[model samples]
Structure formats: C-alpha cells, structure tokens
Target: MINQLSWKVGGQQGEGIESTGEIFSIALNRLGYYLYGYRHFSSRIKGGHTNNKIRVSTTQTLSVSDDLDILVAFDQETIDVNYKELHDKGIIIADAKFNPQRPEDTNAKLYAVPFTDIATELGTSLMKNMVAVGASCAVLNLDIEVFKDVVQEIFGRKGEQVVQKNMDAIKAGYDYMKEELGDQVGAMQLEKGDGKKRLFMIGNDAIALGALAGGCRFMAAYPITPASEIMEYLIKKLPTVGGTVIQTEDEIAACTMAIGANYGGIRAMTASAGPGLSLKMEAIGLAGITETPVVIVDTQRGGPSTGLPTKQEQSDLMAMIYGTHGEIPKIVMAPSTVEEAFYDAAEAFNLAEEYQCPVILLTDLQLSLGKQTVEPLDYSKVEIRRGKLVTEDLPATDSYFKRYEVTEDGISPRVIPGMKGGIHHVTGVEHDETGKPSESAANRIAQMDKRMRKIKNVRFKTPVHKNVKHEQADLLIVGFNSTRGVIEEAMTRLEQDGIKVNHAHVRLIHPFPTNEMLPLIQSAKKVVVVENNATGQLANIMKMNVGHIDKIKSILKYDGNPFLPHEIHSQCKELF
Candidate 1:
C-alpha cells in the first residue's frame, strides 16, 4: 500500500474544478491524511486552463509533490497542458466526450472514462466532477462510500433525489472503472490513515478566523484577488460576534476607515494585494505618524502594476517595509504556515495596539490561497494585549489631554474619544505631546525619536522559525511565507544526499530579527535566501539588517509559480 499520492483535476475556469479538489481533499482530511493543495488558474472569471494539484500523505507534508500520480482531465486541453508533470506510471482519467489522446512520449496510462455521459444520464452535467472523483477513487482503491458525507452536505439542500442522483453518479463511475481495471482495481491502494480529525482550510480562512478570535470588531477592505477571501470570510462570521465588514469604495477608503475604527477603541483591519497595498501606503503613513493602532493585511502577488493577479510572487518585501512617504515606525510580519498565519494574524492586533502603530500582516499568493490540513488551533494561546490604553474615565481636565505624551518607552497613554480628559487633537501633520500640529524643530525631533523608539522593545514571539539540526551547519536556507514547507522538504532530500542544512523562516520582517538571525548566519558556512521575487529582496534585507554579505546568496523564482521541492534541492546542490 502506498503511503502518499499526488492527484490533480483540470478543466476550464468556472467549471467546478476547485469544488472537485475541495471535496476530494476534505474527505481525505477527515481520514487524517495530511494534504497540501495548490491551484493553477488564469486571471479571468472563466474560459481558461485551471487545475488543482493535491498531495496526500499519512505523515504531514508541506510542499506539493514533485510528480503526479493521477490526473483527472475534463477536456483534451487539460491532458495536453498537465501531462508532462506525470510520472512514468501515472494514470490519466479523461472524459470520453473529449476522446482525449495521450501525448506520444508520455508513459502514463490513459483511461477514457464516460464522466459526462454518466453524470448526464443520472441527472445533470454539473455532476461530471463527481463522476471524475469516483473514477479517482477507483484508481486509488478508495471506497466510494468515503464521499457520501461530503456529497450530502453539498447537495443535500437541493432535495433527497438530487443527493441520491449524485451518489449514484459516483457509484456508476467507480463500478465502471473497477470492472475495466479488474486486477488493478486496488493497484494504488493507500495505507490506512490515523482517521483523526483535523481542520482543513486555506491561509486566508485561517487569518480571518484568527482576526475574529482576536477581538477584531470592524474590517474595511476593497475586494481583490487572493486577499478578498479574508474580507469575505469576515463578512460572514464577523456579524455573529458583533463585528462587521465594510466593503469600502476604494483601497484608500478601506484603510482610512480601518484607522478610524481603531481610533474608536475597536480592533480593525484592511486587506489588499499589491495594487491595493500601493494605494493604502499614504494612509499607512497616517497611522504611523498618528500612532493609531491598525492592522493591515498585505497579500503579496506578482507586480509593479496589475501583474499576475492569480499567481504567486513575494516582491513586496521592500515596499511593505518602507513604502509610505517619510520614515515612521511600522511593523511588518510574514507568517510562513497556515498555522502561523492564524496566530500571527491574531497577534497583529496586539502588536499594533501595544506599539500603537500600523502592523502589516504579510502573505504571498500561495500562502494566502493554498488549501491544506492544519492541526486544531489552541484558542488558549491567543492573548489580547492592549498596551497603555486607558479604558476608564479619567478626571476631567481644563487643558487638552496629552494623548501623545513622550515617554522613555515611547508608547503613550491612549484613550477613547469620549473619555474624560481625553479631548485632544489628531492630525497627519507633525504634532507634539498633545497631538496639535507643530512646526517646532525640537518638537519634531522629539516626536520622531519617540515613535521610532516604540518598536525598539517589541515583544514579538519567535520572529524567526528556526530548525537548527547542526550546531554548525554547512549551509543555511532562508525563506518566508509559503516557501517554508518547500524548503523543509528540499532540506530532507539534501540531507539524504549527505549535506547538512539548517532553515530560518522570517516571521517579523520590519524591526528585523537581527539578534536571533545573527547566530544562525554565523554558524553556517554559506546561505541561500529563497524567494519568489527576481530581485532577491529578502536576501538584500538580510544583508542590510544582519550584515553578512560575503556568505549570503539567493535562490529566486518569479515566474508566477511557487517553488517546488526539487527545484530548491537542485539549486542548493550547485552552491556546494
């Protein structure tokens, strides 16, 4: 019995390709199989090649598998475009309607199944995905009954007959494939899974859930690819917890609205991708100077303009770190895993309030959208820390309150607008202790110094996710966001080939984790900073903050796809 399998389903966009993969992965996740899923789609609503590749294993796995074991194709184009990724013994289950032809050099087996015919005969063509799923079950020797619960949950609302028809469609496809393959019916049977329950979700789902759990009462965002899911999730769940989501007119409005909400003593946030982040830069500067606690989620994608809206890239490192005009204190966090995305998202609110500045929770296209199985979250681990925020009514004062009082720690006392003795000015211009506009040179210097010093003692936990296998490693591999899993898989393969490797994934990008990263860099003979950007932004950041220019190198990929494990392994081998 195989312990792992790589399967994919492909078709035109808006044809239930995503739902197919979701149903399949969800069932496997229920059985305790670890799964990692990635989707390939164009930047359109429909009529383009799209596919979802999922890797299922008994043990936990992070990256997509290097090769395909099975490909379920709806159209000839699906087989044509994705066949090269299949292994020699891989199988292709293509719909008979397309009469799919296998490419000459491809060694994978091709089975022309009547997916559409079976679904149409049962009820509707929309159930073609269910037929394909059944054919996949036959190939993997998985029981057709495994899909019963998921199908019911999906189609149960339609009626009892509809649910029965879908189930029948699955059974028909399974039986037809089973009879055709005879001896090979169980050829690819998988080893039994632990059957333990786990949470299956995308990073955006985790982030939204984390936000709600973290006491975020208001969300203002403009919908954009990848990042829109965060706001959408909040839109549904926030109201149940007495919170709400506002779809603002533009990214600028979204950001400023969030800042306003935060100033009113509510945890609020805005989310956007590259273009939207660009629009929110000026507003971010406002939050920085005004010391208004706000959380901003920057889901990074390929770009300078509206580049690769549905693809992967991590080019926003520098822009996110220092995009707004004039330097002001800001915190940028990059969460590598879905689990970290959750905890970091929740902690972002605390950090913003504690430091009284804007905190940007950074993610890449893959990390933001890729679906995977995650261990249950520990709600107890989430703690809300509102530093120096005065909640109680203070003694009424004749003079304006010192809302921005400079202190040794730089974090000033905060109060809601209606609080007694809290009537003070708030503006974007340079201000003194009372937040009044000021042009005094001394006041400007003091205010700048205070805001800058606020993050000097940031209480962030595990700024760098470290896996130091060796006290002194020959090479150090560094990455952030979705690259963490791929790098770990590559390190395992490199170790098997007799090379020592250590990994460091940056969680905190701004107020860089210099102290923690210094020793890791010093202990390694060489370093490779892998990222999805062509400019090696992360590598340069390491050099600028930690300063080990001689040993540091980069493994970059900016072709609108996340890094595969073998790609990383092959590149690192060249450095040695």
Candidate 2:
C-alpha cells in the first residue's frame, strides 16, 4: 500500500499558514520525502480562512489528492470547514481550548494539543505555527533534527536572537508532545538518493528561464495573480542579461508594447491571466493581422470576468482559442511540467517567429504557482531559432521593399529596420505582396490562407505527441499541460494494479498532432481524456479531428484544484 499523508493547517489569512506549510515542506524534503503541496486562500489580508494541504510520501509524488491523513487545525472554523476530508484512520490535532463539537461517529483519531497556549508560554504567539510543526513531528515520529535544520534555514538569516527564540519554541512543543503522548508516534522512512540530482523551482521561474534561453530580449506585463511572478522574476533577471522588462500601465499596453518590441527585431513576450488576456485580445488581433511575432503567456485563472483571480482554472481554453476577433491564425500550446515549461517557452518563441504570428503559451494557475523538484535545464542544449530575419546585405530594391512577399512556405523573408533598403510598411488591413492597406477580397483570402498554412506547417516541425507506454497497453489516457504529470503517475499506478494502461501528453495543443494521435487512438481498446478544465476542450478537439468520439471518455475537474493521481486512478477504474 502507498503510504500517503496530508496535513492541513488552517487559520485566518495572516496566521502563518503558508510559513508553516513551507517549513514542513523544507523539513520533509531535507528528510528525503517526496512531497506535493496545494494551497487555498481568499483574496483578503486577514480574517478569512486559508488552508494549505501538503501531501507527503516516502516514494515520489506527482499530484495533490483530496484525502487527508492529518489535519492540524489552527482554529475551530478550520476544523469545521475541512474535517470531512480526513480519512477514517487519520488524525486531527487541534487546540484544546478551541475544540469544536465534532461528530461522535467519526473514526479519526483526535488529539487536543494546546498549540496557542504553548506558544504563549514561549513568550510570543508568533510561534504557534512552529508549535503545530513540532506537534506534527512528534505524532509522525519524524526526526527533531530535521525540524532544527528547517528552523535554521528559514530564520537564521534574521539574527541569532530570533533564531534562538524559534528553536526554543520548537523544543518546547517537542517536549510537550513527549510529555502528553509518548509512544503513539511512528516514523516514516524515506529512500536515499543523490541530492545533487534534484533541482527545485516553481513554474513561474522555469518559464522565465526558458524565455531568457529563447533570446527573449524584451518583456512587458501588468501584475496579475499567478502570472505576476513571471513578470517579477524576469524584471530582475532581464536587466542582468542585457534585456528590457517593463511593468506596463495595463495589459493592453503590455501586449502592444511587446508587439512593438517584436517589430523592432527582438523576440518579445507578455504574460497575464484570463481578465488581462481579455484586455489584450484587440491588440492580439492587431498582431495577428500585422503578422508580428509576439509571445503572450496566459497563465490562466478562472473567468468570464475576473472570476477567482487567485484560484486555479483551465476555463480559459476556449477563451484563448477564440478570444481574438476575425480570422487570426495563432499558435496555442501548454506545458505540462516545470521542465516542459522551460522548454515550451523557448519553443513558443521559435514558433512565434517562424509562423510570423502571435503565440499564446496556455499555462494555468496550478502550474504557475506549484513548486517541484526538477532537473536543471542545460542552456547548451537549447537551440535558439531566430526566425527568417536576415542580418546580411540584400540587393538594393528599385522601389519600396515588399514586407509581405509570399513564398512557397507562405513565410516571407523578414528584415529589421536600419538594414539597407529593407524598411517596409506593416498594417492591420488586408495587404498585397507589398505591405500596404488593401481592400481587395482576393488579397484578404490569400493572406488568411497564408497565415493558416503556416499553422499547418508548424504541426510537422513542432514536437510530436509524447506517450509513456503506448505500445504495451490496451487502454490509453491522454492529457495536456499540467495534467501530464498526474496522468502519467496515475497510469503507472494502474499498470501496477494489472491494468494495462498507456498515456500521451501533448505539448502542442493547436494544429493538434493529427498524424501522431489518430493512429494511437485507433489502436487502443479504450481512450480516456483527462483535463483540469470542466468542458473538456482537449476531448472536444480530439473528437473533431480523430473521429472516435464514442470510445473517448473524459475525466475533467474545474473546482480550482488540480487532479490528483489517486483521483484519476479511481475515475479510470470506474471506466474499466
């Protein structure tokens, strides 16, 4: 049996829920435990309940699940709100003074630890989270040394005085646990591995690093939840790399400025969430018509209009696909893992330039904010594709240069300003072989077809659909973006249970990998589509192209929480 433990620390927004979770995570990671954490909170500074769930395993973990093994209640309301999620054999640790009227029939082991009271005795209530941490370690029989190392790592930079106080608080809580409940505690063992092999990073940082590697010289964005970290990370790092990062006035300005940077012969990127993406739609269309190579990273959040700004959602799939007006040929792709985010960002820039169109990298809030241990990307392995821009001297044109000069591949040779006789006019209106405003229906059709053809061509050049064990299984599971890791992990578990399962995760969403996907679906006995979005956009796309709608089953979630492997496995079992 897989040993899984989830700890929920809930309290008012400012009561150090995140700090406690981080401290636990640091300790667990140092102790060689594989962990996955998910956090939920309101968009308030104080008084609203916030909950952070951490899933820890002795083995590698890819997703966060629903069942809780331990609930560390900071207040009565926290226990009230999330008590039902605890497993029957689980434990609930709460403050003795604030015990709620829990159900008498419930089988969960309850321990009333006076966490706040202990913190008061330690001279400050600030260490209540620390108290919770110590109590949890005591119950789990986790190493006290691990907690000591975590405390020093987190608070040692402050000063000796603060560090000493926190350490004392930790020891006090540990002692309290030993005095109150002695040998009920049992230790969980973790497998040893080479520490240097792992690289820790959050999704936003990985995306920024990818963009930098892809020769992104200019970035413009307005701060928005989930996507804000990308801007913040790039802003500090961009200047060091001789690049420019601007915090624009709004999302509209951000997109437009990024387009302008692209026009000035630099690879440019802008990032935002659903609401901000709406603001950039008009400018996105303008980029499309002008054939400007700009990358827009829409780290999607829930919405039609500002719905759940700080929450996770894949609802923007349709919005990103058809948000722009008119026939705009743009590439849309999503990365599944932190490593994929890095590589996808670089590939996004390449596609934007090669197609001479805007590309939206559709990442969601889950992947954006989620932290994981990933392998450090090798910069030497990155191939920087700088599009068709020529730096060499061109033969002098008798008249003005034709920027939209159509070729066999529908891609025109592009030249930057200050290049000899390469300057040309770019407009949103229909243009001929020469770049100028034209009202002719024929020119419009040709331009539209040319733009669409570029997307078609990209299908051949881009990465193919990746499958883990496609050949050996009767059932196949398909997913995209952040769902990739969870689905893969689920497939592994199913295989272990004697269910022959295969999996495919797509990195290229648009121009959906027809050649690679059609054959796989045809061979599989059952095809299941898994996604984080409620409407099953990926499922719909597969039905539209692959022609086996009846065989494809969808397991979708849109509750502002990600799909856990256990959840997916349970769903797949139902289908089986």
Q: What C-alpha lDDT values do all the predictions have?
A: 0.93, 0.80
The residue-by-residue lDDT of candidate 2 on 1-576, one tens digit each, is: 236677778888998988988888777766556666667888666878888887776666666766887888888888878888878877777877686456576687777888888888877888888888888877676666767766887888988787777877777776777666666655322334333445556688899989999999899999988898898888888899899899999999999999999988889999998899999999999998888899999897766687787777777777777888887888888887787788888888888888888999989887888766665578886777767877796778776677787666777778877788886777877887668788899887887777777777684244445664656567889887677768877887888888888788766777677888887888788999988777888889889878899999899887777787888899998876
Off by over 4 Å in 1: none
- lDDT by residue (1-576, candidate 1, tens digit) is 899999999999999999999989999999889999999999999889999999999999888988999999999999999899999989999999988999998999999999998999987999999888888889888988888898899989999899889889888889888887888987778898899999989999999999998989999999999899999999999999899999999999999999999999999999999999999999999999999999999999989799899999999999998899998899999999899999999999999999999999999989899998899999999999999999898897799889899999999999988998789999999998998999999999999999999998788999999999999998999999999999999999999989999999999999899999999999999999999999999999999988989899999999999999999999999987
Q: Where is the poorest 10-residue window by lDDT in model 1?
A: 179-188
| TM-score versus the correct structure, for each prediction | 0.99, 0.92
Model 1 deviation from native, Cα RMSD in Å: 0.8
Best by lDDT: 1
